[model samples]
Target: MKRTQNEKILQIQNHTLVVGIDVGKDSHYARAFDNRGIELAKLLRFSNTAQGYEALDEWMRMIMEQKAKTEAIVGFEPTGHYWFTLGDHLQGKGHRLGIVNPFHVKCTRELDDNSPTKNDRKDPKTIAMLVKDGRFRDVYIPADLYSELREAVSERERLQGQLIALSNQIHRWLDIRFPEFITVFKDWGGKTAQATLKNFPTPARVMAAGAAGVLQVWQKHLQRSSLKKAERLVRAAEKSIGRTAGSEAAEAALANLLAQYDMIAGQRQRIEQLMQELLLRVPNAGKLLEIRGIGMVTAAVIISEIGDIRRFQDPRQILKMAGLSLKENSSGKHRGKTTINKRGRRRLREGLFQVMIPMLAINAEFRAMHQKNLTRLVNPLNKMQSVIALCGKLVRVIYAILTKGCLYDAEKMTNDMKRSMKAA
Candidate 1:
């Protein structure tokens, strides 16, 4: 549940103890403070292990008993994945966990001592003070299927990055050794192209093998041989201006790159398969996939990033989480330009933007909306603005479908837009 700042501040009563922890890769430092920002105990140092967590819990209980505090709220900067274990530990122990923005901690560090220097001891106090002032957000830890979905999506992204890096390296290798290779086969990853590269990568090798040799290599993998393609490759090799030195080293490099590309490609395929399985486990995810432009991967990613749609009161919250919420800079009577805040999950925002492109092509309702945004009589948004607006619309649609258990209704969507236009 989302809480107002006042409500959050009220939660930190006199009997409540706020503990701020500075998370690290090896060791963590924590300090306890009363509701009024007074230190309750000395700084506690703990290792990043089970025993260390037990010691920290013991220390917190001691502080609570000594200071006459009834409840304890632990707050900390996320500090990457290091805090995940601690957050789960605290939550499991029945302590309320609050996540303070690392940026807030950095900005507010000078508030107490007015010193720019940083250390383990000074950060916990700043985190605790932020929690006291209600400058923290409730942490959302995915459980069950949501946890599996998140992990699967993360693995897919990692494999995607590896695939891209391997692709770039392969392209660079081809550019140096077989510059004209791309002209023959636009994508070297194709079966025939890959087989040819695996067998005869260099122009010298291509010349030695000739067209028949290349065709022999390709025929082993390809169902049908293209003599014209083979002849073209041979011609390009003959006129090639590729490097002649370091032939042995270049062969090894190309072999290694191709092997890495194949391995990463297989890994990505497996990850997508896993993502598909996990998406089935998520409730109402199939309804999202029913939309024309929303593929399995896109739906899985959106569901993974925004777990448990019931937590959000409205679609606007989802938009804000994606950093698609609009911001303005108006002051006094002067109207100012508005733009997206871009302060939330970057991957989510990118996924939304990418999904819009296919949506504009495949989804009639979305295409109509895009066209209306472009050709409207008054203050028509540009192409990019239209896409951004559509992204928000898509978020609302997904939220409604998931929360209300309704399927996509094209006519209803169009009618709603018409009513909105009339209201405007």
Candidate 2:
């Protein structure tokens, strides 16, 4: 549930004990405080294990019992994956958890002692104070299908990064060994190109194999014959300016690169297949795929990043999460321009931005919106701004579709825009 600052502050009363934990890789430091920002107990040091979690829980219970508090709220910095296990443990143990931004912790460290010195002991008190003042955000841990989807998406991204690195390495290898290889095959990822690279990577190897040999190698993998393409490859190899000194090492290197590329490619394909299956478990995810430009991958990425759309009270929250919400810098006579915060999930923001190009080209409603944003009568947005605005609009559309279980409605969207413009 969403809460205002006052409401959040109200959650901490005299009977409530606030615990702040500075999470770490192995051991964590924690401090206990009451609603009045007074220290209630000595700092507790615990390890990142079941026993450590039990010790921390016991310490909190002891503090609460001693201070005559009935409820407890645990706040900590979401410091990478280190906090996940602790968060899950605390939530499983029925303690309410809140996440304090690491940036906020850094910025607010001077509030108490006015010193910039950072220690494990000093951080927990700051976190607890932020929770007391309602400056912390409630943490949302994805569970069940959402958890599976998040893992799948993360795995896909990791595989993609590996694939890119392998491709770059192969490109570097080709540049050094067979400079003309790319000229014959525009993309080395093609079946014929991959087959040729795997079987005969060097220009000398290709020349030795001859055109017919390369074509036979391709035929083993591909159904159709590319005789003309094979001829071009052989001709390019015959007059290639590639290095000839280290033929043996070059061949071995290319072979290893091809093997790694193939493995990563196969893994990516399998991960994508798994992601498609996982998408089916999400409620109303298919509605997103029903849109013209929104594919299964984009829908899966959005759903994975956003988790349950119901957790958001409105589309604005999703917009904020994507960091697409506008921020203004205006004061008195000196009014500055407004821009996006860019403080949210970067991958989610990138996905939204990337999906917009195809969406603008394919979806008439989105195309019209983009054009209007560019040429509207009052305060037209630039191309980039229009794209960002469309990204937010896409978030709203996805949120509404997921929450309401409705299909994309171009006419209704146009009508709503018209009503908004008229009201403006």
Candidate 3:
């Protein structure tokens, strides 16, 4: 939320105690500093537990009291998953938390003592200085519905990955056991195809069952399947050049893969359902769904990442947070090509691009804007560049919808496109 260096620097005033903590998985080392970056206390080592959190709170309080400070602003690098518990503990104790980038800590460690060597003591001082200089980002932990939504999205992704792996294994089984399986069924995941796979896994079994038996299996689960298709399947199986060895094990492997696929697919559906419910609970999230490209899950994910949109004062901040902000590597004479700086949330950036491609095809306003960007008379952008530009534009629109409670207007977007084109 503290977007400017001045604002961050201002947070560390005369009455503020800056505590730099070197967070670890088991034990953590902390060093306290005053507003002037002067050491306020001896290094304190504490275990990562409830009692340890209490001790940390007491240590900060004792330092604040001893130094005549009123507030404590704790700073630490987000070292993997170790800092989450500590951050939560600090926040609950009514202390402000600042997350310094690990890269910043690594770069700035050598400034003092001119030694690149890093230890617990050296890293704490480096972290504190970075916090004092306002070179840190705010640590945001989504709460309640937003937290639930984020967790659901994460779980869905995990399950989806498993599902993809299962699908690949199933295809691999088919490719080896029955190479001609795809000739009859282009996709083996369809209802009829799945039923056929369930009943007759190999070409030998398919040939044994014949067209009539295959049709019976398909019609058992599904309302109807083509007799002609069944006949084609039998014919393909008869001349199949698939592997004849290990037929039994291969069929069992297919069975296991199919079972795992069904389970993971079901889990993904449940997570999506939970995401939808949570999205509706989040304020102004339904409005996000009104946009053409953002579906229930995508809207939930965007809202989860942005979390309490009022924290951001501008749409550009959202773009930057999503790592869609443009950066260049130019020197005095050498003008370099500009591209997005992927220095922020990776999931948000990936989600935006993933959604944008489908949005270009489905969303009328975005589609038109993309075409205009490509065919513009001056400095026309290519396809990817246009998508990047559109992602930024979309951030502006999303920000407006969340902050101003405005509905997405296709006509207004079209007019804005025309004006932008004219200006270009």
Candidate 4:
């Protein structure tokens, strides 16, 4: 956790070789500089292959030998998945890698030539200079179980997006083809509703099938079939005001969506199992589940995003990483409302907020803390504000549980507010 600029600058001493790279999908550009920010070699362009990594290694070796530099510190913008392989290769070769923020690069690119001209050749130099000035963060490439968990979470997120899209499509189909379908069954994805949709898609079809026919379809999946519900479905179909045109094509579209929905549903279940299995393997990760409202998926997501909590020396880093840390916007005489920066991992932030809301609903300790934040005499927070404040507190509790292997203590989490009030 060498967080400060001085600590970072201290790492880049006289004998250190600072190499900056501009990473791309198929190619990368590299520029070398010393601690003094002096260019030591011409830019080297290479492919995104093993041979290219070796070539970059050789180039760095040649520069080190000529410039009397011993260790290499490589810096680059983490421009998506393009940098992961390169970062892994560089680190595996015994070189330390640093990630300069793209925003920082954009801001600093004009410092040298007073022009914001971004290119492969220009970015490497900009990246290198940033590294030389100690304006980069050390890279933490997760290994083994952490990697598996991260991939599992990412796959789950993708499947979740697809499922949402398919769900929306299904809703649209129901609205157009069978508007009254939702009135009978609140959830269209339910077993009974899905069976009805598969057997009778259109209002005309439902009317022709009759209530007995709808009950027959339901019995195939469920042990019990409701004739009364089926009769209601029949009545709605008879009184339906749904479109009759495009019925065939609409059925086909809904069939495709239903198929996709089933496939994605299966995939989501499988990925969740894998995520939980991977989560169990992580040391002390199960401690997170000890909390009242947190579940396997929530614990897995937090663990995956944090990627080995030992890397974080402080819980504040965790808050900042999750974008839960608040900042005040102000000028000399004018001030603005303080809010969370939201500049870190979006998944981490979203997961924390989502879990916190439910935690407030189900977990007594979190709810108490949230209530205190809202009703406290000084600087009381509103409902949503209290919820956001609790999110940061949850970050600390998670950090401690994973790093310290601590058990969940409602007393500590709520800070014994009852005692404080009594004492007062």
Clash statistics: count for each candidate:
0, 0, 0, 0
| Candidate 3, poorest ten consecutive residues by summed lDDT | 142-151
User: In terms of TM-score, which candidate is stronger, 2 or 4?
Assistant: 4
The models' CA-based lDDT, in order, is 0.91, 0.88, 0.87, 0.89
Candidate 3 similarity to native, TM-score? 0.97
Q: Model 2 segments beyond 4 Å from truth?
A: 418-424
Q: How does model 1 fare in lDDT?
A: 0.91
lDDT of 1 by residue, 279-323 (tens): 887777888888899899998898999988889887888888889
Best model number under lDDT: 1
Give the CA lDDT, 0 to 100, for residue 83 in model 4.
Answer: 92
Candidate 4 off by > 4 Å: 419-424
Question: Higher-lDDT candidate among 3 and 4?
Answer: 4
Per-candidate TM-score against the hidden true structure: 0.96, 0.96, 0.97, 0.97
Residue 365 lDDT (model 2): 86
Candidate 1 TM-score over all chains jointly: 0.96
Candidate 2's error at 134, in angstroms?
A: 0.3
TM-score of 2: 0.96
